[model samples]
Target: MTAHERLHTRAWVLHPDIKSDEDRRAAKPALDEAVALAAALPDLEVIGANIVPLPRAQPGLLFGSGKIAELKQTFSENKIELVLVDGPVTPVQQRNLEREWKVKLLDRTGLILEIFSDRAATREGVLQVEMAALSYQRTRLVRAWTHLERQRGGLGFVGGPGETQIEADRRAIDTQLVRLRRQLDKVIKTRGLHRAARAKVPYPIVALVGYTNAGKSTLFNRLTGAEVMAKDMLFATLDPTMRRVQLPDGPEVILSDTVGFVSDLPTELVAAFRATLEEVLGADLIVHVRDISHPETAAQAAEVDSILSSLGVEQDRPQIEVWNKLDRLPEEERTALLARAERGAGVFAISALTGEGLELLLQEIAVQLRGARHEAQLHLKFEDGRKRAWLFDQDVVREETQTEDGFDLTVLWTARQAAQFAAL
Candidate 1:
């Protein structure tokens, strides 16, 4: 084999479609998604992928003996060194499969963690990925942990940590876990301090969330003009990025671009990123960007909704739906979708790539974020000069009269602004 060929690990993707599994997706699309995940790994060369149909998962090997043998031959023929399973694999199954197929293997959770670790650009993001990866590895009773030489910045699963084989030492892993948690807590506390400081800035937060590769970063770049890495790949953005921008007709807001979500996200990641996602909870409004042209757009949207609910995002939060990627749709389909979006309130069909229909979408964002305004009267004491000044600075005060003790003011503001004022 050529040295260049050996540089990349030859890999294959397998999506097991168990008939008894209630949540199984369409086999072909699932296979496609698995292949896309393989392509996301730069050091992995994907030779092929398949959907292995099964009546039910076999306990010991995850597949029937005959099926396993058939796959072993195929992997040997293709010189496949790694296999990425599109669903959760039991620790025993993972170990047995590696032995049978004579190839390293990673399940859905491990693969996602790898992508996250690779894309993590911030200290907080890196710490969260490491903590999640450690927790995931601890579950594999027979799996080896390479404690040293961790400078590679990944979970040490592919080739790095897996190079050294050792007996499972739960106590060492626990100690490392404790250390990671301590570092993560320190980072989160600093983030909390920053968020608290932002609370005094008076600008509402608008968060953009959706399934992976859903053009959220594209829209964010177009709106904010920041040079964020916007790409046509899953898990492209792993860290939360925020910038302040003034809308065309809306109030100036803090726009946040968050990590894209995926179906059946690993529980460890959900827990680890909970603090990162907490920023979403404080958002006054959410913009749901979607790849309208994707075959599984509906299913992806459902998954995003489920994750949002799991993250404690309430239904009462104000939200707008941006059906992105309109340019990829057929003319007939695009026309029909445009009509549908027009008929639906708070929904806009746009192409963030081509800048088509973005104007109206931005206008709607301004409208939705403006919220409803109402009038209120309040009296402030002489000692509350800061609070009185804040009200005037927001431009919400319509009238003010000086009194002996303090001032009487009449103000018109939205509920969001009112809440910010109360916080002050």
Candidate 2:
């Protein structure tokens, strides 16, 4: 059933501010983020949210007994059906808390995994989410469901009526994970082959990446005229979408809109990010989009930079900074931001909705990628089906002709792609 048909799930959000030595975000914003995450799902109706301050975590219940009782009263008063903790919750803690509060519960990682399961469209995406869900289930071993035998949607992380509880079932989870690994391996190999073949296209890939709800998809749709989802929702753009665009005054290039990055991602969902990082790592130019109007835009940008650093994208790599959502800013601030953008090299303030400052951004892109690829023509024997297929897979063949002894084709490709094709 669709989310709209069912009664909305009343939920509460909490951010645990445990005592920490270093590197902790402000509790209030973290609570706000947790609430927003809950709001992302159509079926979730978040009625209450707060930052729960703790000196240290409890081994059994995650919260102190007093605090748990107090929160239980609050949950009962608010009729909270689900409790979303914006941090890790051990299996014991989860089970205890659920019973104590008489409500369903999802830790930070589990909630994100559920979101991924709901949104994953591609085969590889679905498999990755399922594998991550299984890995997550390995710890809980509670009533869990898997799609190992059926290629269906959802990982069944969300608990509801008629859930089963099969004790001592670690073996089932391990076996499912093995099968999922094999399936994912096959998908990845096929993906690798596609990427290798796609590299032959001389178009330098310009990738747009930023924090969720940063307007990357809006900008991508504006530039490419592709019908990519550009909602104001978090993680609205899940799959990496690529489109070819012919620049008005420059060579054609590939514009790729990748999955939006999230902050404080849990280790359990690391495999789910593989597809996103793969796209970013392969980009010739990275466009870091920022919602300049957001209060925590600086923190969001820092997280993006940190993730890129972890991906080994060097500091000297070609990049552009786009201060997006300028239309959402006040007139005075937008003007000031525009002025600042003009002063900074490779920075553009644009409102993708209104087409403000995009001309300059496009021109800058053209300048950056100028002379990056060349037009070439080649002739291959009829027996060279693999080479022909590889070239076609690259989407570089602009023209082709059948000849007496072979085939003639025209292509536009980068020198590196040409070398790889030659090696093939």
Highest TM-score against the true fold, candidate: 1
**RMSD score of candidate 1 (Å):** 7.8
By lDDT, who's the top model here? 1
Any residue pairs clashing in model 1, and if so which? none
TM-score of candidate 1 versus the correct structure, residues matched by position: 0.83
What do the candidate models score in CA lDDT, each in turn?
0.86, 0.84
Q: After TM-score superposition, what is the CA distance of residue 168 in candidate 1 from its true location, in Å?
A: 7.6
Candidate 2 lDDT over 140-178, as tens digits, reads 665233322243347756433323333336777888889
Q: Which pairs in model 2 have colliding backbones?
A: 202-413, 202-414
Query: lDDT, candidate 1, residue 48?
Result: 89
Worst 10 residues of 1 by lDDT: 142-151
